[model samples]
Target: MTPPLALYIHLPWCRRKCPYCDFNSYPAPAAIPEARYLAALFADLDADCAFLINHRPLSPLQSIFIGGGTPNLFSPAAIAQLLNGIRQRLPCSAAIEITLEMNPGASVMAQLPAYLAAGVTRLSFGGQSFSIRSLKQLGRIHRPRHVLAAVRAAQAAGCRQINVDLMYGLPLQTLAAARADVERLLDLSPSHVSYYQLTLEPNTPFAQSPPPLPAADVSADMGEQGQQLLAAAGLQRYEISAYSRKEAQCRHNLNYWTFGDYLGIGAGAHGKLSTVSGGQVARVIRLAKWPQPTAYLAAHQSGHSQIAHQRELSAADLTLEFALNALRLTAGVDVTLFQQRTGLAAEHLSAARAGAQAAGLLDGGAAGRLVATARGLECLNDLLQHFDLS
Candidate 1:
């Protein structure tokens, strides 16, 4: 059977870049070329779909995610045009979950109804923190009041599945402050919550001139407390940084964590696809579009290839990549999924699995699943080292 497929549409323009964000995002110009960009996006998607159809059977798209610097910055008419074009080109599942990432700084309230009408079923708000001090430190443009207003607007728009992205372990963040942020988010009764620990990524401004971060122990305590608070509010921790109500998990991201196939379109988007070659051999291919918006559009207009990079994964590469994603899930994936996704036999992982289990990093349950122990989840880097195919 062909693996489930998803679509990721990246919007690389944000009002301003955050100090800690290392994503391929840039500040928008005075005017966004929405029409031309939408045309380029469909052209990029066409190329990817052609490649997939030639290599393997095309599965109905299970989900579509519109994410980026701030997709909410675009007008709803643009979003509607994009979504309509997507449906016209691809065979989308009847029950596909479509998500659009929004930021409070943008006037999301005015666009929520149009977005819903355009087939967006989920709204993910980028509300990093409720504390004004932390928001300023992070260079976020939105105030706490904006976050509240956006959530209220989404709720009033009859959006049932809402996700608020919150960050802990900010510069000079205290446990009390972190808990307060979680408490404020819980009050909104969002269907999903992404509580992330702030990390200084390489090449980011924060990495070059680091802020005064909390101590390691303090950060850990804040995470534990926040998780406890979320659990108390009936949100289950399904993945490392994600919590959701029952059946409310982000399907697009879940597909990613499970090593399912997805086609990525837009500037700096990355994609992974699996195909069976030579009758019995399975090959996994990685593709990435041009990183710059101007370059991507130029390539699209010229009918030139938008993919800046493409490579087929070796057996070892597939094994390591599969483990890298699957182990991030709290419940983990079935042992058979390793083979189904990677085309590698379970025996290929026996030695590493045994070593990890012996080291108390993996659970040795008889349920035919590969699960990480609490210790493994805490020391995830150490556990992943055991599966290093290199």
Candidate 2:
């Protein structure tokens, strides 16, 4: 069976790219080329839809995530036009979740209602931290009060679904400060919270001029204690860094964790698609757009493919890819999904599964769900070493 489908639209222009950021984002010009970028997105989407006809099948979209340099930088009218254009090009579910990511800047607060009116059902604020010192250390533009004010504005606008992102283990951060961040976020009662640690990704400014961060053991303690705080606040830990109320788990991200299918459109967007072959074998294909916004737009205007990268997953590649995502879930995945999503033979992954289970990093057994133990979750990279042949 085909996995559920989702859509991810990347808007890659930010007012100023964050120093700690490594996403394919660039600083914006005085005026963003919204109309031109949108045209390119539709062209990319059209090509993807055509590929679906030959190698993929059209499935009504389950969710749409508008991520960005800063999606809220665009006006409500532009967002409305984009969403309407997408619906005309693809069939979306009646209850489809439409999420738009926004910075906690004061300017975006006034735009919340207009966004909701334009069909954005959920608003995810990049509130990173609540401490003034930590925000400055992370080079965030918004002050602590802006985060509180943004959530309040969302509530006042009658937007029901909200997600707030918070980072732990910052430069000079103490465990108490991390707890305070969680406590303040819980006060907002966001439906979902992405409580993640700030790691120095390669090629980023942070990686080059690494700051004096908390000690490794202290960071570990910060994560463990922070999890306890969120769990006690009625936010269940679904994935390692994600928590949500009983039914507020992010459906779009859940699809990714489960290795479901999704279409990626826009500069620097990536997508995965699945198809079954020989009535039993599953084959997966991945596609990515040009990372440079100008290059991508030029390719579209010139009628070029605009795909900077593309590949088909080998069996071993599929095994690792599936495990990488599925194991992030606290509850793990249905063992049967390996074959369904990857279209590979069971033996391809059984030995690796047995090895992890024998090491006590994994729970359950050969017949039921595959789960990661608490210790396994803590040492996820080490646990993955068991499955990584390369």
Q: List per-candidate RMSD values in Å.
A: 1.3, 1.3
lDDT of 2 by residue, 152-226 (tens): 999999988899999998999999998899999999999899999999999999999999899999998999898
lDDT of 1 at 345: 92
Taking all chains together, each candidate's TM-score versus the true structure is 0.98, 0.97
Evaluate residue 203 in candidate 2 and report its C-alpha lDDT on the 0 to 100 scale.
Answer: 98
The 10 consecutive residues of candidate 1 with the worst lDDT sum are 274-283
Task: Note the residue pairs that clash in candidate 2.
Answer: 282-343
| Clash count (model 2, backbone only) | 1
Each candidate's number of clashing pairs is 0, 1
Index of the highest-TM-score prediction:
1
Clashing pairs in 1: none
